[model samples]
Target: MTEPANIPSDALTTDVLIRHRREIVDLKQRIKNRRLQVLGLYGTPIVILAALITWAGLKVFVWLHSNTPDAIDNITGFVVFFSGVTFAVQAVAEFSKELSTRRDRKTPVRELKLELSLAEERHVLEARRRTPPPMDRQASYKERLPGEIARLRKESRHYRRIHLFMQWMLFINSAAISAVTAWYDPPQPAKGVLICLGFIVTLITAAAGYFKPRERAFNLQLTADSIEQNATALELGISPYDAVEEKRNLALFATTVEDLRAEQRMREQQLDQPQQGQQGQQEVI
Candidate 1:
């Protein structure tokens, strides 16, 4: 007789997700980073305000030395021109990156959303109250959750490393800009350039922050779906060969399909048996 599958003690209770605590922490950090990105995006106008204020101050201060009001206007005009150019260039770069990232995922990311929905649906439909007690009804499902979380955490680590690196760059650039500002006597060109560069880089960091972690969340859902779909095929009596072949065409996950195939083969072989028919005939004779 086949050993009964291990069911979690309480069939009605859902598994407490445990494997990927690191991923959960990372995901929270990503959210905080994304919010900061949004705040940075809004901060662009503040740069213009600072530049304008500086130009105004220079114009007023120069009046004491040369008594020429026109000097302030000229400096202000130059500042405005350079500022406008920086904005344009940054916009173009952002637009290009947006286009490329969009194209990379031709199909919209439904993996995370759908996986969540399916998991909830399955939990509801199984109706633990109806299942036989002392049975490991939820064992398979519970065992699978931790692995899913662990895999998601693993998937996010790649993107997180890239993000952490970019943040370090920003921190360095900010310091460099502050240093240049302090070193110059008048019309600080080095400071100006560093400040402008720092602002631009900060914007870029924000954009990446918004989208990258979402991609990782989708990665987790994609993996969970893959395993669930594979298991479903086996339960439906599909042959191991067919499960393997079918999984090859799926879009997002990369798991070894052999275990599922083995399961299908085992089930098929069991069902194909002649059963107790021959023994009954011999007994009757």
Candidate 2:
């Protein structure tokens, strides 16, 4: 076979690469905190405003019935009480946050230095630690292809199961909301709980739509099937791979399999992002 050429001279050492990754993790954690803080500052007021609007609309219903103990009266009273409590809690939290920020500023610089030093020590220790070797040998296409197929199939099953569960939740929540609103005329507390359930269902629906877990599963399965076909053809001396010399063809086949796996991995990482929208949804909860 031909020798591969041109190793890059500017490649980073393993320790430097790992340290960079650790720094990235730390940076992301800081950004996540700042984002959540901003969201909370903005969202609490919007939620309170929504509660007020809901309260006002329900008040008209109560007034029309002349303060009778109907569902609308109970619901209006409930919203007023809860909205007041929510506003109070948010106020207190904001006050506490201000105090905490002041305290953080007053903290000693020496303490900050110590914390930084400890973080560095932890990173160094982690970088020095040795990982266990991979269980499977991947020196050849024959060895690697089956492992890739198994891995892809497992991932597909995982995502498919999650997707199915979310689908069931969406259906069940929709049915429950319909039943409570139409048939039973549930009391105030039950109605409030149902509303929260509806919100949760909306959150789950949003998440499922954003992530497209079923689509991911389908893609993974498709890739696995394609790789399996290629592996089978190579094994059986079928066309394409059959035309090439055995050793060279095996190398080419391995490269193709790895490339496919890499593409799948990149897609998986994109799907895995815990960005602002998901974080905002969690705040709603």
The best candidate in terms of TM-score:
2
**What residue pairs are clashing in model 2?**
none
- What is the C-alpha local distance difference test score of each model? 0.52, 0.68
lDDT of 2: 0.68
Residue 74 accuracy (lDDT) in model 1: 76
> Clash number for model 2?
0
Worst lDDT run of 10 residues, candidate 1, spans 100-109
lDDT of 2 by residue, 202-246 (tens): 999998978888989988998899899888887888865786567
lDDT of 1 by residue, 56-168 (tens): 57657765566546766777677767766666654454356554332212222244345445555554555544454322433344346456546645765765666676677
**Cα lDDT, model 2, residue 20:** 56
Evaluate residue 43 in candidate 1 and report its C-alpha lDDT on the 0 to 100 scale: 52
In candidate 1, list every pair of residues with a backbone clash. 7-136
